[model samples]
Structures are given as C-alpha cells and as structure tokens.
Target: MAPPTRACKYGLDCIRNNPAHFAKFTHPAKLVATRAAASSLSTSKKLKNQKPILTSTPNTDAPPSLSASDDNRDFDAEVVAATHPTTASIVALVSTAVAPDVLANISGVTPIRVLADGDKIAISSYTIKRTHDHYYCTCPAWSINNRPVDARTCKHLKLVFGDAYEAARLLWKDPFGNAPPAPAIANKPKRKKQEDKASEDEDEENDANTKKASSTKAKKSKKNSDSSSSASSSEDDDEGTAATKYSAKNRAKREETKLKMPALLLAQKFEPTKTDPTGWWISEKLDGVRAFWDHERQEFVSRLGNLFTAPDWFKEAMPKNISLDGELFGGRGKFSETVSVVKTNNSPHWRKIEYQIFDSPSMASQPFEDRIAKLNALYPSKAASFLSSQSSLPSSSSSTATKNSHIKIVVHEKCKNLQHVLALLKTVESKGGEGLMLREPQSHYIGKRSNTLLKVKSFYDAEAIVIGHEKGKGKNSTVTGSLKCQMASGKEFKIGTGLSDALRIKPPKIGAIVTYRFQELTNDGVPRFPSFVCERIDANKPSDAVVCILKKD
Candidate 1:
C-alpha cells in the first residue's frame, strides 16, 4: 500500500489551502474531501448513539488545563468564540456535554452524582447547583466576579469541551485555513515602593542599635574615670614621697630602661606517678602568652612592658588596682605569633589575645585566696551600669576616662594530685603545646618562686652549677672548651652537644650555674646525654648538693 498522506492523518484542512499540492495527487481533491467529511459525519453519529464508557484506566496523554474545582465557563466560551467564530455555538454545546464527566474524573468523583437534567450540575458539599442560564459553585475560584460558574470557563468547562469540541473544529475550516491569534491580557501592578519602605525600616533599626551601643560605652568610661580619681586622691598623702621619686622626668627615664622581665622557669624532668610529691600543689598549665599586667601604670602591660590598648568593652571587664601575672593567649597553637604581637606597641592583633591571669603579683604579701577574692570582686558576673555603658564618640577621646577598669581574667584551677596535673599537661601537649605550670594553693604570689611555683614540661634537663671546663673536640677543639658542670643533685655531666661557635670561645665561668638539656640517668646517678641550653644567672645551688658521677660497675 502507498504511504498515507499528511492530509489523510490530519484531515481535509491540512490541504484545504494548498491547491498546488492537491493537483499532483492521483485522487481528485473533491473526492478526498467528500470521503473525509463522510467519515467525520459517521464518527459523530456513532458517538451520539453510543453511551459514555467509564473505564478504570485514566487518560494520561491529555494535558491538564485548570484544576477540576475551577469553573471558567466564560473563559471557555470566549476561547471557543475566538478560535471557531462561525461554529462557537456548536463548540459551546459539545463543551457543556463532555465537561461534567471529564470534571468528575479529574476530581476523583463520579459524574452520576454531579450531573443533573437539562445541562445542570450539583456540587453537593457546597449546596450549589448549576445550569446553562444560571450556574454557580460555592468554590472560591468561580466567585472572582460573581458570574455564573458556566460563564467562568474554569477547569470544569475545559473538561466539558473535551474531544467533541476539537472534533467540531476539525470539521469546520476557515477560508484562511490558519490558526487563530491568542487573546491579550492586562499587566499587573508593581510593588517597588512597599519593598523600599521595608528596606528603610530595617536600616533605621540597625542605626538605633548602633546608637544604643555607643551610649552604653560612654557611660562606662565616665564611671571608670570617677573611680580612678577617687583612688588616686585617697593615696595622695601616703604616696607623696614615692610619687615625687617617680615624677614625670624620672618616669620618662625609667620607661627608657629596657628591663627584661624574667622568662618562665621550665621543669627539666617529669615523673608520671599516681601520688603527689610532698609540698607540691598541681595546677594546669594554660597554652597562652606570658603576660604581666602593671596595675600602678593603669595599663595592661605585656612581659616586655609594651602597653596593650584594649577596647572599652574589654577594659571594663579587667580587675582594677592590682598587677596580675598570667598569659595572654588566643586559644592554643598560636603562642609564638601571640608573643610577637604582644611585644609590639599599638598592634591591633592583641585584641584577639585573652589575659589568663593566674596570680596577683602586686599583692604578693597577701594570701593567695585573698588575692583571688579581690580579683573576683573587681570583675563581677553582672557588670555595674557604669561599666556596661557605651560611648557616643570614638575610642581615641574615650581612653583616659576608661582607664583602671576591669578586664576578663581566667584563673587556672589547682589539681588534687600529680597525676591530675600530668594528665592536664599531656592533654595540652597532645594537642600541640608547650607545658604546664604548678602553683601552690596556699602560697602567696612571691616575686621569686619561694618553692611555691614550679613548671612542668616534657623532656628532662638539669640546671648544673658550672665547676670547670674541658677542651672542645672536633670543629670546636681550637675554640674555647667543653662545659664540665655539677647538677643541683651534685652529679657531674659533660655537655658535648648544642655548643655554638660563640659559646665555645667563652665557656661559662666557674661557679656559674647553666641549664643542660639531658635524657635519662646513668648507673652512677650521673646525667646521660647532656646538651647545653643556656646559663641560669638567676638560679642558686641548694645546700645539700652532692657530686654525681657515672661509673661502669
């Protein structure tokens, strides 16, 4: 059989306007048109005679227009009138006939319950019934203008048109034989002004918060100034002589003197045991920068005496009128960087550093607990209204007034035993740290240890009192000599490693105690694998020191 033509599949309209193409076909054009018309007429007659089939299977190929509840009867009428102007009435008739069944199927309801006589339908739950002349559904979609539901051209109307409406359109052909143009729709209004108004409101709220914060800061600064003035007035008579000695000229000269504060004394050995040693109070060593706050100066000074100017918020949290010895840290693992930043004057990086105050060094004569009580009282949990207040102006003009205010101070807890101390130290080191510091709970914060403070670090080393020197070997042989020293334990050890060129030229003098990094002890109680670190000018030999010698038994 010959291939079916496009006209045969689409219908007579496909070739209605193309006379040139129709002329080439063997069959006469009029005969083809007659056949198509006869077929369509027969199909229409058969559809009219047959009853509607209610099948379980759904029609998946059909595109969903509007929802089943929508009643756009008028829209459907307008669409049909626009698309098939001549056959609009027939189209409407077909639409009304098929819509009820299609709408029922789409809505998952049975048409038998919804359909009534004389082109009427009842939406039972809403108590609304519809007819061609006066249709209505209680559904909100059909109430846009309170028109008859059938005139709304909702989803119900679209479903009613179905294949019958399309079939009718296929039967009729326009002389132009072209598809109809789409209807125009009105544009919606914009909401730019409302959006702009909302944005402006948000900006106003932010501005209010900023103003409140500034005002609070200002009040705090004013309060601190009043307190500092009162404190100075009370001490004026008693401190007259001392104040004269530290007058403007003298103070300026003293500031020029670069007095290096003592470095932390690190422990040489660690004994991991269950029991605590006698007279030793264990405490956790915080991983932070070594800091010394000079209360007399009314400034937070680092170990290097570089003043750390903090924000009013932070300053308002620090303890007033007491020097504190502690660490300024930004968590762990940032020690070297923190130290470098603190050493510099006016560096903004110090803002990230927190001062973990462990001792009130200026109150050395007072009991440890007493000092802590004073520090705690200075920085209360709930700040005073003055301290909590904000400033309306910038920080530069606000500095003098905010002086001598409290800052945040973290105190290290004293552990119960050596094991707890060791555990804390191990935790810090395991997470990449330096070591732990132990402070006696009952002891005062003395300038010197006074046997009250001890540092605990990994890697054992001894601070040996230098007795003499031995000639250096290999590359350092021609320079100075090797260090022959006696430990506080009185044991003798030769530090062969860690000798620099300068150290070799001028070895530590006799009677000078120097630090030696070493490993385990030998059989004869002598230090094994000793290496030179640095000389300890501030250390002294114990009275019961003995000579330790390593001998092969």
Candidate 2:
C-alpha cells in the first residue's frame, strides 16, 4: 500500500488544513469545547499529535509571563485581555462561570457534582477537605501545578458552578466597611426667632427632677446607715450574756449530735469471731475537708468555724433551715491544698470545694430512710430523685416552697451488717482514705454517738509538748498517772497509751516536748485518745510544742 497521505484518505484528518480552523483550536473556550468533543471518541489514535493551535492577537498590556511562552503567547494574551477590568469584577466573572458539578468532582471524596442545561445547573451536595488552607482535587488535571492553586480554586470547582470561588473572595468584605466619610460643615448664617417660653419650663422641670432623685438617693443611704447601726447595737448587746448562752446551747447540741468526720479511725487488727465480730462499712472515703454546715446562718462552718472563709457559691448551695454534716471535698488527693484554701481569709479556690453531705441534723428526729429521703429531695438532679416531691423541701416548709434549691445531698446505700461495714473501712484505708461512717437505720438522729453513728479511721501520729501531770488514782495512787500534753496546734489532750511502764513511772521531764499518735480529732479540738509516739529534743518551750490550730483565717 502507498504511504498514507498527510491528510488521511478517509476524509477524517488529525490536523486541520485551514489556518483559521487551527487558530480557533487555540482559543481557551474553543479548546475546551474541542477537548470535550475529542474525549467522547473511543479511539485514542485519532487524537494523537493534536496540539492546541494558536492565533495571533495583539498584547498591548500582556503580562510578562505570558509573553515568555512563544507557542501560546497570543492565546494567553487574549485570555488575559478578556478578564474583567477590575480584580473584583474578574473574580465575580470567574465565580459565575465555574460549574458546581466540576468543582464537586474535583475531589472524589466529596465531589461537588453539577448537572447543567444551558442557564440552569443543579449542584450535588458534597464536603471538601481543606489542608493548609488549600483545596486538593483527586482529579487528573490537578497535578499540572503539582499543588492546588494559590487562590485555592480547583478545576472541578471551575467546571461546576463557573467562578463561584472568585465571588466568595469578593463576598469576604470588611464588616466595618470603609472609614466613614467626614462630616460636612454648615456655612449658612443663623436665623433669629422668638424663644419659646415652653423651652425654659422644660429645662426647669428636668432640673427639679434631678434634684428630687439626688435627695431620694441620699435619704435611702441615710436609712440604710441607721438600720445598720441598729443591727450592730443589737449584736453588741447579745455578745455578752446572751451570746454565751447561745454558744453554750449550740455546743451542747453539737456535742449531743453525732457528726461524721472524714478522719480515719485506727482499730486493732484483730481477727473476727462469731460472737464478737469486727464491724465495718465499705465506702469510698472522700478526700474532703470535714465541714459542719450551719443552715441557720446559711454558711458552711468548718470543725472550727473561725478557721475558714466559705465562698458565697458554697453558701448559695447550702440548704436553708437544715444543718448538714458532710465533707467539703475538692476532688481527690488535695487534702492539704484544700485545707490551705479553706483556711485563707478569701480564696478563689473555695468555690471548687463542694459539700458531700452524708448526714442531716434536722432529720435527727426521723428514721434513717426518712432523713435520707429528705436529703435526696434537696440534692441536685443527678444525685437522687427518689424522695417524694413534698419530702424534698426543707422541713417545716410548705410543699410548694422553694429554698436553698441548688444544694445537692447524696445518700449512699446502707450496709447489711458490721462485716460489710468493716470491709468498706478496709477498702477506704487501703486507698489512702480517712475512714467509713456507720449509721444505724433505726436510730434517731442525735449529736452524740447515741448508738446512731460511728466513725472508723487509721492511726496517725501528731507531735505535742508535755503540759501537766495528773495525780494517780485508785490502786496506783502513789505515782503520777496521766501525762497531759498540748498538741503543736494548741490542742490539749492526755496521752495515756503507748507508754512503757518505766516511762509511766517517771514521764518525760515536765518541760520536755514529745510526739503523740492519734487516730482522729475529737469535737473539743482534742485528739481522739492519743498515744505517746516519741520524745522531741529540739523544742525550746514546752507550750510551743502544742499542735498549732490550722485556721483558714
């Protein structure tokens, strides 16, 4: 067969003969159309060597980069010249020309596919992933630049909705707009007119109102001062005899009441027996400060109220008309820090402390279940909602009454017997906790043990100074018996245990300081039956050896 003609004999030709036809192929719009038409063909051979032809076009203001390219310089200049005059206008034009569907398919992950019919195009919903503020398309043509465009516009985005990306740039306008225009000045001469008497009357009325308001405010201030003075006078009068009486009554009541302290009580590690079994309750010993909340004052009072300044938030959460015995906890393992915070005159951390109430003194007269029921009602929603709506309110209040509504009190489940309780105590101790509380379900709420509440803790040591000696009693009347010592915190107590017979015979010198091991704190600021730990030889004065009372103030 003869060599194929340059123009194929079959009429179908790879190269066009007319220069005009080839020039049309160079136009961006025409090139895109031709590419689309060629893409529909099944045979790749027919499209070989079909380079985009170019047409000459004058480039008066062509970009330097475009002129550098010889083959498509005219085409590039033409496209650049065709762009809208203003950058913003060009962006808007590009934004509108880009097809949404092409943008969707830019990334196969979440293609912004579009179906277009002339003027109308439907956009398919898709999510685009942005990396480093640039959009990447999985589409084949994206690799031409080896990265997404600096404008973050993708070819798929351009093909779908035509130039929407550019429009988005224009839409990102400064919220405040441009600086406001300078105010215009008036140059006209003033006109003379008779002044209205009503204006003067209005001014006088406004001045009178101002004077009246000032007078009213001053009078209210004076009234408040008078009321404050009267209240102070009354407080002063009550500070003497009445105050003492009140304090005595309160102390007596508190002493008579059974308060649960968070301190662990140490017990002898003895085996259990059928008749005399060791009793215990398993409870997560909350690492919180022991606080006695006095509902009457709407304030949380520590074991020693004078020591800490309770935050207003805590006071706000406190239930009115109900005294709660609970732990003022601030999460876990922050006991020393929590104590330090509560002891400060005014601490921001005090707000973090929460009262994990375990007992209610107001319910002392009721059964354990009933008291708990009342507590549950006062608790915020998450803790408990078991108690009846009426029982939830503070005692003696109407069922519809709302008071101290934000306080939350959680009641733990009761143990079956002493064995179960002891297991809980062990668990608490093993976890570096204070102890467990045992409440008799059937017993009434009382201040003292009264067979209602019991505390279990581990043995811990405290240092004290020898204060005095107690004369012997009964069979050993000849020798001094109890050695009275004061803790370094200024707490006085006797250490009658852990003393050798010889030490008992002739206790450490009167001025000598020593350490005492105690389990928990007693209500009267004394250690719960302390025992001698060791002698301290470095102390100066015996009184200085006493345990210093750690106060919040």
On residues 1-553, what C-alpha lDDT tens digit does candidate 1 reach at each position?
Answer: 2322344333222222132333323333433423222222223333444433234233222111222332321122222222222232332333454444333223222121223322233332332443322233443223321111122322232233333332232223122232322221122111100000000111111000011000010001112346556444433321222112223454356447623453322222444453254445444454455556665555555443434444445555454666677656555444334443443333345566566565677777787777766665654343222112232100111112233222344444546666666676665555544456565566666564244556676656567777888886567678755787776676666776787888888888899877776433543456545678888778876222232321111
State the TM-score for model 2: 0.34
Q: Estimate each model's TM-score.
A: 0.33, 0.34
Cα lDDT computed for each candidate against the true fold:
0.41, 0.41
What's the CA error at residue 79 for candidate 1, in Å? 74
lDDT over C-alpha atoms for residue 475 of model 1 = 73
Q: Could you report the Cα RMSD, in angstroms, for every candidate shown?
A: 36.1, 32.0
Best by TM-score: 2
- What is the clash count of model 1? 33
